[model samples]
Target: MSKVVLITGGSSGIGKSIGEFLTEKGFKVYGTSRSPERYTSSKFPILKLDVKVVSTISDCVQSLLEQEDRIDVLINNAGVGITGPLEEIPLEEMKSHFDTNFFGPLEVIKAVLPQMRKQHSGLIINVTSIAGYMGLPYRGIYSASKGALELVTEAYRMELKSFNIQMTNVAPGDFATNIASGRFHAPVNENSPYKTAYGNTLKLMDSHVDSGKDPKIMAEAIFKIISTKNPNVHYKVGEFMQKFSVALKRILPDKMYEKLLLNHYKL
Candidate 1:
């Protein structure tokens, strides 16, 4: 029997690209969307799932396991973005952001871990972002959420090693996707101190994503990662500069890195 792969947020964007790519490679692929009816794929079946809802996550995994017997790979690619000034952003909005981006993936991991542990072998790939490594102007909450997920991926690697279950955090810098359009923007205070700066930086961030690399590149990278017997704990995907900037941040002085981010976003 072919190895089974389950991907969340597979209705479109990077998740859909990866699901289709893996299916073409002969894996039994299952993809999930809030409304499966909106996405039709003959090669891989779509299941209804909303990462924010624990019941939907449990039901989705249960249904998949009943038919496939095992899930060889679980990709936590379902997430949402929130942007605005942190100080002015409402607490509820931040909670909602974390619900989808951080807790959502955590809940899915919980739902699938039992099956993976039972098999004594499986891979969990959490799709993080380059933003996870640093807090960006006007996108601090989104950064914080991804950053939290990245930390969990590290801890999981150590904890699951004894069980022979593997985990990887795939951090993509930017990809051409509808994420920008779908992102939730907190209500901005007109008189906030950083209002003008926030708006300009937000615009720059959107443009950056608009010109990001194709999602196919990320899909190809993920496929290669899956084929490897022992992949790295983390993989960074993006253009030369985007990936390089991550490296630079590590080596640069704190103030220098902050300046680079400010200049990049025109803040």
Candidate 2:
């Protein structure tokens, strides 16, 4: 039997692309969406799932296991983007981003881990962003959320190693997707101190995303990660500049890195 794979946020974007790619490769792929009825794809089945809701995540996984006795892989790919001055963004709004981007994936991880433990082998991939490596102006909340998830993945890698379950955090740089339409744009009123700066930075961010790498590259990376016996702890899918920026942040002086980032955004 083919390995069973479950992916969250599979109705569109990177999630959908990965699901299709895996399906084409002969894996039995199951993708999730809160509203699966809205989208359709051949070779992969869409299941109903809302990552933020623990009960829904449990139900989805249970349903999958009922149909197929094992879940060989769990891909936590559901996430949202939020942008604006962190201070100006409402606390509730920031919570909403975390609910989807951080906590949501955690719940899904918890849901599938029991089955993985029983199987004594499984792969879990968390779809984080390069922004997680460094805080970007106007995208502070989004960065925080992805950053949090990356940390969780790192911890889980060690915690679950005894169970033979592997965890990998895949950080993609700006990707060509409809994330702009779904992102939460925090309020930036005239009185806000970072109003102009937020606008300029947001514009630059959008431009970068518009010209970002294709999603297929990420899907291929994921496929390889799953196929390998011992995949690296972290994998980045994007242009050299974005991936290199992560290394740069680690080695460069704090002020120097900040200066380079500010210069890139023209801030």
Candidate 3:
């Protein structure tokens, strides 16, 4: 029997790519999208779900349950990016990012965990980013959200290990996705604060994203990962990110590593 996988943020980009990829392999995929019409042509089941809104989670899960009776894999891939000076970004925007990127996944997990525990088997793959491991200028909010999810995923895996629930943290390096070009007017600012200081760093992060690796590479990596019975606690895709973090941790001194990061962003 083919396995049933539920994915959040499956409307487009990496999330949509993974959903289609898994569907081709014959898995029954239930994918959540804010705009269900956008994915009317997708291979898997498309359901309307806005990750930022907590109330929508259970309804979506219930819809999936009616179809498959159980969820074998739950992948949290929904997230948003707000790039700019952290100080300039409003507190409400910061909270919005956390609510969507972190708490959204937590809610989904809480809904599905009981079913997995009853089945005595399941896999949870979180689509985090390299920013989770290392702080980045201009992307502070995004990085912080991913980092918190990483920690939560760690505890979730530890506690669920006895139930045979496997967890994998997928940290993709810069990937060629439409995220950098996505919608959003510049957030309204109460006042122009730290304008000059944050300009260069924000430009640097945007440039790095422009030169990111292909998203398909990361999608293929995900396919290989879940196919294995014993998956690693964390998997870093893309050479640019894998080498960057590993080298920083092993070769450079603490101060030197910090200096390199700052230099990378021309800060």
Task: Give the whole-model CA lDDT for all candidates, comma-separated.
Answer: 0.90, 0.90, 0.80
lDDT of 1 by residue, 1-267 (tens): 688999999878999899889988898989999999876644589998999999999999999999988999999999888889888888998998899999999999999999999999999999999989988888899999999999999998999999989999999988899999899886556878987888887788789889988999989999999999998988999988888888898999999999998888877
Task: Please give the range of 10 consecutive residues that has the lowest summed lDDT in model 2.
Answer: 36-45
Off by over 4 Å in 3: 183-193
TM-score of each: 0.97, 0.97, 0.91
lDDT of 3 by residue, 1-267 (tens): 899988898878888888888888888888898889876788777898887776788889888888788899998998878777776677887787788889888888888888899899999999998788767777778889898988888888889999999988998877767777662224434465645546666566567678777777877888898899999888888776555785576677888888877777667
Q: How much is the lDDT of residue 19 in candidate 2?
A: 88
Report the error of model 3 at residue 111, Å: 1.0
Q: Model 1, residue 202: what's the lDDT?
A: 78
Rate residue 255 of model 3 by lDDT.
84
Better of 1 and 2 by TM-score: 2
lDDT at residue 201 of model 3 (Cα atoms) = 60
Model 2, span 50-73: residue lDDT tens: 987889998999999999999999
